[model samples]
Target: MEGLELTAFQIISAVGTARSCYIEAIQEAKKGNYEAAEQLIKDGDEAFVEGHDAHSGLLQKEAAGEGEHIGLLILHAEDQLMSAEGFKTIALEFIDVYKRFDAEKKEA
Candidate 1:
């Protein structure tokens, strides 16, 4: 609708896409598709940067004494952002483990 609301939606949408990409990346890694998994991680990083930039804009506004009322939507967007970050961490770890497994399998 308006400023804060629109920005919150943007954060949510971008991070949601990022979260999905991270999950899909894990799936690809599990299937031994390291290149695809890496590509998805790259895609997720791109989306995450978009959301992070949007969130930074809000922080900058607040720093400039242009703070607005923090609504539930904004709170939810922050939560989504945190969740996506956590998922990315997990995805990277999983990919590493899967890569190790694949390498060991090939050796065996």
Candidate 2:
């Protein structure tokens, strides 16, 4: 496969894993496992950075007028990246709400 193909694969793998991590974080928070939830969020961020970097590289390539011809797989990768980004935002908000609930429970 070509370098662009490899990069797209890497982005897909990393962002998919990040999405899973973000979901796991929300699940953990729902269970009141705030520590684990926070850890998962952190882990997700790390994975997201890796994926984001790969995506940015492609953008940079395009900016430099070196973009590979577009492909369906690359489009799929971009879709996954957007999904991951949205998931991360939702995960953070969910975690925050869970934390507040946990705090209220502790006080009650």
Clashing pairs in 2: none
What C-alpha lDDT values do all the predictions have? 0.99, 0.94
Give the root-mean-square deviation of each candidate in angstroms. 0.5, 1.0
lDDT of candidate 2 over 1-108, digit per residue (tens): 768899999999999999999999999999999899999989999998999999999999999999999898889999999999999999999999999988998999
**1-108: candidate 1 lDDT, tens digit per residue:** 989999999999999999999999999999999999999999999999999999999999999999899999999999999999999999999999999998999999
TM-score of 1: 0.98
Per-model TM against the reference: 0.98, 0.94
Worst 10-residue lDDT window for candidate 2 reads 1-10
User: What's the count of clashing pairs in each model shown?
Assistant: 0, 0
lDDT of candidate 2 at residue 79, scale 0 to 100: 96
Cα-based lDDT at residue 11, candidate 2: 94
Task: State the lDDT at 22 in candidate 1.
Answer: 100
